[model samples]
Target: MRQEDIWDADTAARYDTPGTGMFAPDVVGPAVDRLAALAGGGRALEFAIGTGRVAVPLAARGVPVTGIELSQAMLQRLREKADEAAIPVVVGDMATATAPGEYTLVYLVYNTISNLLTQAEQVACFRNAARHLAPGGRFVIELEVPDLRRLPPGQPAVVFAAEPGYLGVDTFDVLQQHLVSHHFTFDPLITGDRQARVGRSPHRYIWPAELDLMGQLAGFDLESRHADWRGTEFTADSPGHVSVYRTAGKPVSSGP
Candidate 1:
């Protein structure tokens, strides 16, 4: 089945785990603030802007925002929150979709780049972001580095989360550089708890340096990379990075 189909209406309706996980106010605030500052009074575009988790608030902050999303169900949820005029969106692949205007900022958050599933596709996504960028505009990405270091040799999978009625795990295909994440959530014990809910998403994991090369191939220069939206320094131990790449010209302002 197509990956987009996995996010059907049933899944999209509950996609927002607000005030928890990535949707928490503390998490969303810093990312929007950083993105807004980088936009510098110019427009911003989002790739796979799922459920307007970041777009709506960023738009509320007065920056024009547009999006390209593959899942119609996800787009429906976004539209329910904000009118089309407030946050215009294109319904298509992020690697190939086009909105009507050039933008100062284009970003993919929550490691969404991995959803492309191939090196060439990921590179195409970079070129696509560059395509929408005005000269001197910036492209930003929030991505998690592969957690292979923690995977014991000969082990093909790792469990990252385990709690009351919830479990999350990732299985790796080392030869193909692919990973599939499995999420399982069970109903409360009081509800008989027989029917379990589950979902899986596959991705092509990539390295930070590899992405820099992709950026270069797409006419962007590496500008900044931080461990988080709060500007923490990235290190060998950092599990993720928020990277900014700029078109080969002076931007309206220094992008974070």
Candidate 2:
């Protein structure tokens, strides 16, 4: 299924897991800290700003913010958190939608880039971000590295997470660079007992190196890359990364 279709009323409702790894203070603190510093006291934009998980707090940090999102259900949740004036959002595809004005920083966080199911769309996303950014502005992305090494020689699927209440697995189509993450969750919604829920989202996973090439194609230069928001070194074992790509034609400060 398409990425846009994956985020419906149901998914949007539960997107922000308050106590989960994403929303915890430690995780949120570092991410906002890094992004705000990159914003450089100017306007910021978010691609696929679902539920305002990071946008809300970043705006609270005194940066004017805008967003482009395809899912109205997700936008509805964001609206509940912040007024439209505080965070203006365009309801359209991130790969093509244009938010009002230019920004100093444009960020797609938490593996959102994978949402675009094709390489062409992903490249367009880079160009779209470049168009919205002011000269010298930066484009930031937080994404997970594909875990294909875990797949046995002939296997194209792997179950990464299995627990008492949840199960998560990923299947890969190496030839097409496509992946689908499957999730099964248990909750007690009725009868005060366990209720089973299932979800899946398809993605075209791009490698870190390929992503850099995409940035270059969109007139960007790689500024920095880290294993996390805290700027840890990205080593072989790192599962995800935070990358910053500055527009090449303009002079941007390469600093911490």
| TM-score, cand. 1 | 0.96
List model 1 lDDT by residue over 136-245, tens digit each. Answer: 99999999988999788999999989998889999999898899999888876633558767888898999999999999999999989999999999999999999999
- Name the best candidate (by lDDT): 1
Clashing pairs in 2: none
* Candidate 2 residue-wise lDDT, 1-256, digit = tens: 7566799998998788885768888988899999888998889999999899899999999988899899999999999999799999999999999998778899999999998988999999999999998889999999999888899998888999999778898998999999889998876662236566889998899899999999999999998999999999999899999999998555544436
Clashing pairs in 1: none
RMSD to the hidden true structure, all candidates? 1.5, 1.7
State in Å the error of residue 223, model 1: 0.4
lDDT of 2 at 75: 94
Error of 1 at 37 (Å): 0.4
Worst 10 residues of 1 by lDDT: 187-196
